[model samples]
Every structure is written in C-alpha cells, then in structure tokens.
Target chain A: MKYAYYPGCSLESSAKEYDLSIRACCQYAGVDLIEVPDWICCGASSAHATSHLLSIALPAKTLVQTEKMGLHQIIAPCIACLTRLKVADMEMEEHGDLKKDVETVLESTYKGSVRVRNILDVFLNDVGLEKIEKTVTTPLTGLKVACYYGCLLTRPPHIAQFDDVENPHSMDDLMRAIGAETVDWSFKTDCCGVSMSLAETDVALELTNKVLEGARDAGADCVAVACPLCQSNLDLRQKAIGNKFGVFYDMPILYFSQLMGLAFGATTTDVGLEKVIVNPFPVLGAI
Target chain B: MRNKLEEAKNIMKVAVKEDTTAFAKEIQRKCGQDVLTCYQCRKCTMGCPMAFRMETKVNELMRAIQLGLRDEVLSADTMWWCVSCETCATRCPQGIEIVEVMDVLRETAIKEDYYIPVESIEAFHKVFLRSVEAYGRLYEMGFAMDLNLMLKDPLKDADLGPVMMAKGKLKLRPHKVKDLKSVKKLFENVRKLEESRV
Candidate 1:
C-alpha cells in the first residue's frame, strides 16, 4: 500500500524517534510512504489560538498540496497534526464559504479529497492486524504496556471520528497483535498538557505526573503513546515530575510505532530507541 | 426582624443592564459556535483537565459569553490555561464545542489588545508562529532560543539542551521549504483577511 506521509514539525525535531520508528514499522509492514513535497507546518495550537482563519488556512495549504501530488490518503504521525488537518478538511467540506475563504488564502481549491489518518489508524485499520501479526519476528510477551491515547487522537468525537473517544482500543489491539500485554487504564484519553509544557511547566508537569502515575498504578512496564506531544511531555519531563513530586518514576515512554518496530525485528538504533529520556533497554531485554 | 430584612434587601440590590449579545455574536461570526446552546450544564467544567488552574471554569466562560461579559472573559486566565484537550467539547451535552469557543475568545482578546493574564502563553504563541512563519516548520532550537529571549531567561531550559543534543533530537539548522514564498504569501493573505474582518 502506498500513501503520502506528512511528518509534521515535531517528527523532525523533538520526536525524531517517532518519525524513525513509524517509517521503519510502515516499511516492515510493506507500506510505502511518499513524503509530501515541501510540506509546511500544520499551524498547531498557536495558530488556532491566535486566528481562526489562519488555523484552517494553514492545514488547507498542505491538504491542497497533497491533492496536487495526486495522493488520496496521507498519514500524519503526530496526533496534533492529524487533528488540525482533519478539522480543516471537515470544516471546508461542511462550509462552502469557509472553503472559499481558505481557497482564497491558499490560492488553490481544496477538494477536501485527501483522507488524513493517524499512524495508529494506518497500522490497525489500513494494515490488517493479522498481516501485522505475521510480520512480528519477536513477540513482546510478558511486557505490559499502557496504551495512552491522550487527547486529539480520538477526541471531540465529531471531528476526529476515529475510535471510541472515551475508551479507545485501537492502540491496545495493535499492541496485542504484536504480542504485548495491554493494560487497562483510566487516563487513556487524558490531556498531556502539550503546549502548556512550554508555557506553564508546573501545570504540564502535574498533568504528565497523573498519566505516569496512572500507568504505574496499573502495573505497566512502560507507556506506549501515538502523539509527539504526549511522548515529549511524558518522556522529557519525567525528571522534573520526579523532582517536583518527590516520587521516583523511571517508566519509559515510547511511541507505539517503536514497539511495533521492535517486534518487526528492527534494531534499537533503527527505530531511534536510544533517543528516549528514560532507558527502555531493561524492559525490552526482559521480554 | 427589621434589621435582618434591611440587610437582606441591601445584599439583594439589582442593577439595570445593557444589551450584551455583541460578544456572543462576535464569537458566532468568528467560529460559528453558539454559546446560547449551553444550558448552564457543568459537564464541560467537570471534564476539563485545566479547570482547577483556570480563574473561570469552562461553564463559567460559557456563561460569560452568553451574558456578553467581554471584559470579564477576555481578562480571565482561563482561556490561556486551556490546552485544547477537547474533553469539554466531547462531554458537552449541548454540543457547543467549548474548545472552539475558547479559541474564539483568545483570538478576540488578542485582537482587542487586552492585557493577557498569562504572558508566558502569549509569548510562546508569538515565538511559535514566528518560527513557522520564517521556516516552513518549527526549528526546535530556534524556537527555544527565541522563547527564552522573549521571556528574558536565556538559561531557563538550558540544562535539557545537552541531553537533547546527545540524543540527536535537536536540529542545529532548520529545513526551509522550497516554496517558502507561497507560505509567506499565505500568511499575508490571512493577515489581510483578519484585518478586513476587524
């Protein structure tokens, strides 16, 4: 299967491992990812918070470019990017006036033809679970994983319209297909305090602490995530969370794709496993 | 009994109000979210993760919008604290999409040049957009540098720099898209449209 890949900003920077692992996993699953040429940022939280028009227009520009490339489906690994792109597409399809405004800003008509899918969706739905199971060279047996959906992935149900917003099970199913134990946790769709991590570190730390503590309480060996922001906050800020809360949590936060890559026999370096803040080698070695 | 009645009368004094539908109308015009649909249900507030940190809760903000309390809503730190988790929007029985409402309020606050209670969030937004405007994508190092400079704390997150570098996560240079001029033009067109709306 072939699809266009829009590896938003975080993939190339803070969440490079996500990009690496996602590509590796897709390749192993026999999926071809053609990167969108000269794709711009999706104008994430800042654009939406600042200007309503710009937020829609920003993603519209990229979607229009994808149409120009003649790709009908695109996989945006970052949950936030998928959310922004999907929302823009939905708005333009639903409102002709907004579509005209966006077309005017982008100087191109958005056909609303491109289907935006997150990586989790690409794996679970696009590539059948049975097919993925057949490709697993190393079954992650006995390794308990807390599958964190965070927000934006399946939220505001009308816009995302993916898995069950409250209790998403796609990631869990994907993990199970790879032979990993998926733990049932309450904070599956909780907020990770994303941009707040940069603005208000304290609040973001508190939210991240809750997610990490929840995973730990449920006896998860490590946390598996699908969003760049979730991985960044949960992985990078664990130290600060520990120092602030006077609790030691050495839990490793990993992208779901990385775990799949591991099961597909990809090396740690191949998937950028060493890039994580907390070392995951111990847990990976155990299984 | 007379004294208690007088005290109660003083506490219950009411004032005449002016028409305040303009705030709600403005929100509707901007994002098409109708705050009138909200029936004082606290579901949004209950589901909001940042409600505890907000000066005004999600339901309170909806009430402020309905009442056209422009000054009260604009000056409050609630909108800035919202992470746009969409939990409120997901749980809202009215289907008001409180997240979009918050976005509209934030845009209005910025347009009116209200005193932003959370300067850090405003600063972060500015730096983030500036980075994307210059380069097609966000330059992590440049963004951090610019944010630190704007916040006047160059060494704020300095400790994480080396660690990130070691992991090969920090990019020393930004990748500018080939058709950057088009991106610039898009920004200009949007800016012009925003100005025209105002």
Candidate 2:
C-alpha cells in the first residue's frame, strides 16, 4: 500500500534517524511513501503558540495539496505535526465559519479529502499486525521498551481519534508484534516539554526526568517514542539531567521505527541508532 | 512547600486582575468555555512531570479559573511552573488548551507586572523577538549568548557547549542573513502589520 507522506521539520534535522527508520520500515512493510510536493512547516509548536490562523493555514496548505494530488490518507511521522494537522482538520470540520475564513485566506477551497495518520496508525491499522509479524526476521528477545505516547498522539479523542486517549494500545500492539516487551507505565502520555525544552531547561529536565524515572522504575531497558521532539528531549537532554541531578540512568530511547527495523533484522547502525545523544551501548551490549 | 504555597497565593492574589470576565472570554474558546466539566479528576495533577516541582496543583488552578477566582489563578505558581508539554491539555476531557490557557494567564500576569522570575525566560523571548525583529529569522548562536547573559547564569548553557565544542559549531561569530537590509525591512513590515491588525 502507498500513501502521501509529510516528514515535518524535526525529521529533516534533529531526528534524521526517524526519517531513516521510516524509510527502512517502509521498505520492509512494502508501503510507498510518496513525499507531498511543495510542503511547508506544519507551524509546529511555536506557530500555534503565536497565532491561531497560521496554525490552520500551515497544515491546510498541505491538506489542499494532498487533495490536489488525489491522495486520501497522508502519513505524518512527527506527533506534533500530526496533532496540528489533525486539529486543523477538526477545526474546519467542526467550525464552518473557520473553514470559510481559512479557505478565503488561502484563496483556495479544501474538500477535507485527506485523512492524517501517524506512523503508528499506518503500521497497526493499515498494514496490519500480521504483516508486521511476518517481517520479524530477528525477534528482539528480552528487550524491555517503554512506549512513550507523548500527549499529542492520543488527545482530544475527537481530533486525534487514533487510539485510546488514556491507555493507547496501538504502539503496544505493534511492539508486541515485533517481539519486544512494552512497559505498563503511567507517564506514557506525559509531556516532554517540546519547545519549552529549549526555552526552559529546568522545566524540561523536570518533565524529562519524570518520564525517564517512570520508565526506569517500571523496569524498562529503553523507551520507544513516536515523536521526534519526545525523542530529542528524552535522549539528548539526559546528559544535562544527569549533570543536573547527579543521576545517570542511561536508557536508550529508540524511535519506534528503529525497534521495528531491529525486529526485521536490520542492524543498529543501519537504523541510525548510534546518532542518539544518550548512548545505546549498554542496551546494545545487553541485547 | 507551605511557605511557598502561601507566597504563591499572596503573589497570585495581587497578580491576577480582580475583573476576569474579559480574560475568561478570551480563553473560553480554548476550554470550550465549559468551566464545569472538571470533576476534580486530578488526572492532570498526578501526571504533570513538573507538578511536584511547582508549589500548587494544576487542577486547583483550573478550578480557580473556572470559579472566577481570578486572583488565585493569576497568583498561583501553577501557570509559571507549567512547562506546556500539553499533558494537562491532552488529558482534559472538557477539551481545554490548558497550556494555552496558562499562556494567557502568564501573558496577562506579565502585562499586569506580576512578580516572577522573568529574567531568564524573558531574555529568551527578547532574544527570539530580537532575531525575528532584526533578521526575520532566528540566529541560534546570538540568541544563545544573549539568553545566558540575560539570566546571569553562564553555567546554564553547558548542555550545548560540549556538542558545539566537539563539532566546532560554537563560534563567537554572528552571521547575517543574505540581503541583510531586506531582512530589516521584513521585520518592520511584520511589526507594522501586527500593529495594524491589533
């Protein structure tokens, strides 16, 4: 199966490994990810913070482009972008005046012909767990991973409408399919502070620490994240948190795609596992 | 924590405006203007990573806002402590932009000149605005140094220091955008547009 793809800004830069893992998984899954032409930033965490219209317009531009291309479903790997796009879709569908107002600004009408799905949705729903199970060339035996949902992916159930808002099973099911253990953790849907990680390090640390500590305490060897921002904050900020609190819990935060890749017999380096700020060496050795 | 809570309450009492109708209206769309959906679930409080770091309950702050207890909402340490991860927003069944609501509360508090440890974050915003205002884009290095100096915490920048040092990325150099004059013009135009719209 093929679908249009929107790899938001973070995929292009901070989480390049996520982009790599997406390509690798798609290769194995037999899904063609056709990039949406002339896509702009999804007005990510900051744009919506600054203005309401820009947030809608930014994602609407891509939605309009998707409609023009005759594609019905688009896969956004980034959780923040997925949320923004989905929220925009909900705003337009729920609020008629907003749809008209946004349409006027773009000077083009959108027909809501597109559905935004996160990568987790694509693998679990579209591709089916049986397909994923078939591709498990190397089952990740005895690897414990904490599935971090990171708030945006399963919120305002009416908008995201992907999984159980409180207790999501899409990631867990996918992880189980790949032969990895998923932790029953409370902070799965907790926030990693996104842009605030950059502006407020202390705040970011506190948030990151809670998630890390929760996962660590829950007996997870590593944490699997679907969002790049969550990955960055958890993986990259660990050093600072270690330095800040004198607690060094070296948990390897893996992009969910990386886990899928490992299950499919791809090597760590092949999935860009070495690029993570927190060293995956300990877990790698354990495996 | 009790002393801090009393301090937070005292501070919020003076910080939030006595009249909250307009303030509430502006944020009503965010929380769906439904102030009654909160059944004291405390889901937000339990899951907030920074909740313990802060002195007050996020649920308490929302309840205070819903009750039109403007002084408490404004004065409480909750808004300032909010890291805006949207954990609360995501969990809130009433569909509150709890983070955005916190922003409005903070911005309102700032406008009212409520006392806060504003220097560090304020500097980041100032540097952000400066970059946007000057170059029509953000310059990471320049903004980085400006924020550090503003906070008077040179040690705060240690996180990126090592990476930049190893990669030879942290140069004490300022880079200007191409067509530098046009960037300045762009900023001016943007400012003018924002003012006119307001």
- In order of appearance, the predictions have TM-scores of 0.95, 0.79
In candidate 2 chain A, what residue range of length 10 has the lowest lDDT sum?
A45-54
Task: Extract clashing residue pairs from model 2.
Answer: B12-B75
Top candidate on TM-score is 1
- Local accuracy of candidate 1 as per-residue lDDT tens digits, A215-260: 9999999999999989988998888988999887999999999999
Identify the runs in model 1 with alpha carbons over 4 angstroms from their true place. Answer: B1-17
Top model by lDDT, which number?
1
Global local distance difference test of model 1: 0.90
In model 2, which regions exceed 4 Å deviation? A285-287, B1-23, B29-31, B36-47, B53-57, B63-80, B89-100, B103-198
- Model 1's CAPRI class is medium
RMSD of 1: 3.1
C-alpha lDDT of residue B65 in model 1: 82
